[model samples]
Target chain A: MRIQSLCAALAILALAGCAADPAPTEQFRLTEQALEQAKAVGATDDVPELKLAEQKFTRAQGSMADQSFKNARMRAEQAELDARLAEARVLTQKSQEQLTALDARIIRLRKQLGEVQ
Target chain B: MSVFKKLGGGLLVLGCAGLFGCASQGSESALQQANSSFQSVKDDSNVLRNAPRDVIRAGESLARADRLSNYWGSGADVRHYAYLSQRYSEIAREHSNEAMNQERLAKLELERQRLQLALREAKLLSVQQQGKWLEEQIVSLATTETDRGLVMTLGDVLFDTGEADLKSSANRTVLKLVQFLQLNPKRVVRIEGYTDSTGARQDNLQLSRARAQAVADVLIDLGIDEKRIQVEGYGDEYPVEANASERGRAKNRRVEIVFSDEKGRLGAAR
Candidate 1:
């Protein structure tokens, strides 16, 4: 009877291992949107985070094709965050460039004011 | 035989547990790293203020990872949630940085505007201080008030020989003209160029026009409206003196600025 119970417990463990997670269609959509938004904000492939996001998103697509719902969801979720980080980084860089340009203009104005005075 | 089978089953369970324990070690460090990242961002008031939602998501993911770390054979799930939590924290930090930069940009833009205004006012004030004396000098230089209008003569010395570029010596006169135009916004001027009778007629005409354009360009650069100024080249045609002597030719090679009345009505072109 103990041997039978052990076999039954092993079978339950195997069943649990094979449990199918629901397809992460919503996650795939969210990942795609994040990538598109990053691109819209001028996040190019040169950005490391954007490149990572693209690579992971492609792998997530592969997982989806293989019906590995858990893998697909994890990869997609990470890719979404990576794309968002890329977008934020690009915007911050652009703002920094603007600040530099404005600073140069202010310096020039100050010099001109000095000359005027 | 039944004892042997039970021992084998027990060994199988031990082997599975050993495998999970090994995987859990790797995930344990990942959970720790993610928890630290989340803790840093969660405590940053700027991050909390700028990216409350992302911070909350990071905390939630870290909690989920922490819960999964306690479960046997859930290493993959624990690591996945840890990775997610770490990414959320990083994203939160970036968002806060961007927000702070935007705030600084706004403040810098305002400062730039204020400085620009101060510079403009300082320039106008300096010009006003020199305006009266410069006006007298200009009136004396442009003494010929013929039927054409009030005409000021810029002698050839203001430019290099055969070149249209005005020298630095012309800056004061140019600034005075700019100030005069700014003060009398309704007044317009026609800049006419004349050359000596020494060069070829075609070349002289082109040179005269280029010289006139150079002066007009300086006026435009100094903030005078292009519409208020007309340019013309009268190459050796209407000389103020004969081209018979060096003195006469020197007098003839000049640029004449014709000013309109205060009503913005320009005199008819020559």
Candidate 2:
């Protein structure tokens, strides 16, 4: 009976371990999708946060492959947030560039009108 | 068998305790604060409208944080997601603020351009009005625009026959001409005198020259710059009509004052 209880306990612990550390596939996929979205917004070229997010996402994939689910999840969450930040930064930069171009156009028009030298 | 049972019970107890430990989530207040901050930002109309993508990203992060806390009891990771959610929401709000500022600047620039155009139009209109006033003054002088500029005829009635001095009655017309000339100092004047065909050529030439010089002297006395006046005598040449008629001879014995171009340069007689 004692041998039977030990075997049962070992089986339960093994099952719990398997359930608890499921590969973090969903988190990895979500982070990759977020990175793609950032790239779509030109974040990859214009925003440093995007590159950092990519690095973190790659590290998260490595952790997931190593069966470090908790670390992988944490890094994936971080990567997702970084990608969002990058998207926001790229949008702000684009708006600022448009405003700058408009200002230059206004100055040129003002000069043409002889309002400015 | 008894040792095995005891080992299994101990392991079960330890596992239960560990499960309880994981269940006891920390950073609950942190997650709550982040949610509250995000809610406030999302409530802003500008952020909701202008930064929709950023707002959606923030919502997703907040949802992830909620899931991590409720399903896994991961305190530190939940707090991180919450923080990111709050940060992203704030970024959206910041983007809204910048967009609004840029829009306002664009509107102000457009208004500035409009006002400048209006001012330029007003200036041009004022110059045109001044030109109209000058045209009216020229009409009162009986002057006509010509290739040379404005030409005003001083009939021979202003001087006695065979005389070089101007009649005192001509003062009023001379004064008006003087005012017009003073108003347009950049314009020069040329005075030309002619005679009828009755006089000898030499005497007529000398008399015409004298009459032209006398008229020029009057203009100088009236404050016109002496350097801007030129005097000439045509001596019965370039008649206005046939000198055989008395009325035509009266017209021929007259002085004509020609105004110069805008640069004060007078054209030669045609």
Candidate 3:
């Protein structure tokens, strides 16, 4: 009975470890995807926050390499946020540039109309 | 002891059910948020066309999230797919905004070009009509449209014999000319006076000059700008007919008005 109880305890311990210590693979994937999203929007050209996001992603990779999954997950999550911010920034910048060009063209057209009149 | 075992089993079943319920709730919230984000931009044609792949990806991810939340009972996968759905939706929204802006800008550019063309055509039409009206008025006056310019005669009926003073009856003819000059302010005119060969040369010259000056003064009074009127006297120099006949002499005693070109400059052609 003592030996059987010991085996059961060991099995429970193994199950607990398996359930509690899963690697943050999904989080890492999410971070990678977010970074790709930022890149797809040309964040590298105008988004200053993209550099910070890259740094955080590199730190996440370092933590993952060291098997510090909790730390890696935290860094990856933060990197994802930074990447999302970079994407939004790039989108806003591009919109503003297009709007400014449109405004200039409108002004030029208005001046042409004035001359015609 | 059997009752206690039954109770323990029931509690375990209940606990598992509770855990599953919590996971389901979390998945539901994520799926809901993702679906709402997708719906927000679904109607945008720009999003549909320019970012078609992104929009489709978002829809597919949302569907997967819904399936995971409803059946798979894996909150992790549900949340992952839901997040992807929302992210792709964002990308679609961004591209859609850009496409819509481009379309609007193109429309504005076209509108401006159209308006400019319309204004130019209107101006051209107005100029053509103005030129036509001026030509018609000159024709109605029985004036000669010569290469030198328009020439209209104010006969000796406008002045008494051997006198430079204008009679009141002359005002009717002069008023017609004033109306014409007022309508075409850009055109300048020269007034030349002449007389029969019966009078002494110096007297005829002086009388002719006085008569031309009188007409010019009256034109100025009638609002024909003085700067546009030039007066000269020619005592029997250019005759329209022979001096020997009474009718020819009557015609020679005249004041001829010459209208200049658009620049108000009378050329030396006449």
Candidate 4:
């Protein structure tokens, strides 16, 4: 009975060890890179997605400090996506502004053409 | 003791089911939302064409989320993947929009170039149609081929008294000048302004400069390159006539356009 109880205890310990996640160092690096790329593309805190990314990234860092590898990985992964979305949003807005300016120029050109005719 | 143990095991199983039930409910909704987002982006041909990789990633993430939702105690992972999938779909849509806009911008740019060319040609033709008569008038008015090169004088009558504004009567002459410069693209011009000795010297200087600038502004508006024109204010100096008589002062109050040679060799400014 003593041997059986010891075996059960060892099995539970192995299971617990298996449940614990590995430190997500690579994921953290990827998150940081994504955040930097978003900022480079003119994503400011005014952008909601960028704000979310910053908040989550900070929380992910806190989780890392606490050794909650699962939480840290999840938050960092989400943060990366948020930052990417922010960057994409900023690019889309810039392209839209360009379109508006182009449209205005075309309209002005047409008006000039009309006057000339 | 055995019956009590059986009751305890049953209660434990019930409690575990309750926890998983709540978790699965939330995870199920999140998965559904992500699936919807992915489906929309996947259906969009433009999104597929422009952001195929992102759309594929979104679908893959959504599938992972769906698979995770079937397991107990994996609710957080399911939600995280679902969120990622949704974000990817949104990013894909935005990228496709940007691509479409860029394509439209290119087409519009081409159209704009074509329209610009048409406008320029129309202007040149209109100017040429009125060219013959205006050319004669300009030759008669441009009386002097002085040492300062071909000098054409625009008299004080072209401006309102004490005002720097050119009268509408000067429009034909200005348009003709614009046409002449366009025809001789290489030729440059220096517009010099003079005022009568009636005003204060300082005032005369400012007025002369302003008048010259006014003519230059019109030339620029009519499409002459600003670099091709130089403006100067002679004030009461270098008078074509004496300041003693009103007719002489009127003659002195003038703007003279000095043209460069065919090779754009402009004479030195006086």
What is the C-alpha local distance difference test score of each model?
Answer: 0.89, 0.79, 0.77, 0.89
lDDT per residue (tens digit) for residues B19-76 in model 3: 5776676777888898998997787776788788878988998888777776433676
Pairwise DockQ winner, candidates 3 and 4 = 4
Of 1 and 3, which scores higher on TM-score?
1
Error of 4 at A9 (Å): 7.6
Per-residue lDDT of model 1, residues B74-173, tens digit only: 7888988998999899999989988998898899899999999999899778766666466667788664787987888899999899999999998888
Model 2 segments more than 4 A misplaced:
A1-55, A64-74, A93-117, B12-26, B51-73, B80-84, B98-102, B119-144, B147-270
So what's the TM-score on candidate 3? 0.44
Best by DockQ, which number? 1
- Best TM-score goes to which candidate? 1
Q: All candidates' TM-scores?
A: 0.67, 0.48, 0.44, 0.64
Ranking by TM-score: 1, 4, 2, 3
Candidate 2 chain B — worst ten consecutive residues by lDDT sum?
Answer: B18-27
Over B149-257, each residue of candidate 2 has an lDDT whose tens digit, in order, gives 7788888999999999999988978887777677666888899899998879989988888998999999998788899999999898889889999999999998888
Clashes of each: 0, 0, 0, 0
Tens digit per residue, CA lDDT, model 1, A27-73: 99999999999999999999999999999999999999998888899
TM-score of 2: 0.48
Assess candidate 1 and give its lDDT: 0.89
Relative to the unseen true structure, what is the C-alpha lDDT of residue B34 in candidate 2, on a scale of 0 to 100? Answer: 75
In what order do the candidates fall by DockQ, top score first? 1, 4, 2, 3
TM-score of chain A of each: 0.88, 0.73, 0.78, 0.86
Calculate DockQ per candidate and list them: 0.51, 0.12, 0.09, 0.41
CAPRI classification of candidate 1:
medium
